[model samples]
Each structure stands twice: as C-alpha cells, then as structure tokens.
Target: MTTQRTITVDQARQIVFDAYTTGLPQAAAAKLLTGQATQAWVTSEYAALRRRGIPAMSGQGSLFDPAAEN
Candidate 1:
C-alpha cells in the first residue's frame, strides 16, 4: 500500500526544476533570486518562467551588452 501526497502546481514546478535543470543548484538559485543577485538570477528564473507560460525574451542580446539587450 502507498500513501498519496498533495502539492500545488507551482510547488510541483519548483520541485521539477529542483530535480532537473543544470548549473547553480535549486537552493542557491532560489536564494540568489529571492535575495542577492536578482538580475543574475533572472536568466535561470526566466527559463523556469517559460515552462509556466511566461514568454522568453525576443531577439539575440547579451546581458553585458546594453545596446544589444535593448
């Protein structure tokens, strides 16, 4: 026999990324996003956001290149 558990969709997504994705493990990513280095975290966060209906940025641009980014 087995017991079932309940979890929200958002929670499930978080778990999915935690279980998958490469570079900067989940805890560090979360901390970086929620705490310091918000902009740096945006790259990975946006990737996750894309999975949940958020669209990716258009065109090619370097975060380091202000002109290209715009």
Candidate 2:
C-alpha cells in the first residue's frame, strides 16, 4: 500500500484555480493533479472558492484579470 500525501485547503484551491484558469476540463484536471479523474473533487473546490468570494467559473475570466470580468 502506498501513502497518500495530504494537502491543505489552500493548496487544493490553488491547484483547482490554476487548472481552471488554464482551461483544463474538470475530469482531466482532477486526474492530472490527483492521479484520478474525480470531477466531484474539482466541483467541491470550485464551490469552496466561490464561498470565499473567489471567482471560479468554467470558461470564464480569471480572478486576477479585471478585463476578463467583462
């Protein structure tokens, strides 16, 4: 059996955010980041970011770019 590495919520959010900004599909991003295409995990992280007032929309603009907000 292999040990699983634990990541903090912030780290998870960053990974998801990066994937989102890079236009990676949910399943593909999740698989690339965690070795499994768990879309639910990606969804959950997006929700969490939303709750924290972070902009996280698929195919939408990034949080750091004000011009993308339009």
Name the top lDDT candidate: 2
State each model's C-alpha RMSD to the native: 12.9, 6.4
Query: lDDT by residue for model 2 over 10-46, one digit each (tens)?
Result: 6766778877666666776677668432578888775
* Candidate 1 segments exceeding 4 Å error: 22-70
TM-score of 2: 0.50
Candidate 1: TM-score? 0.28
How many clashing residue pairs, candidate 2? 0
Which parts of model 2 have CA positions greater than 4 angstroms off?
33-38, 47-70
Q: What is the lDDT of residue 7 in candidate 1?
A: 51
Candidate with the greatest TM-score versus the true structure: 2
Q: What is the TM-score of each candidate against the true structure?
A: 0.28, 0.50
Q: Rate the local accuracy (lDDT) of all candidates.
A: 0.47, 0.67
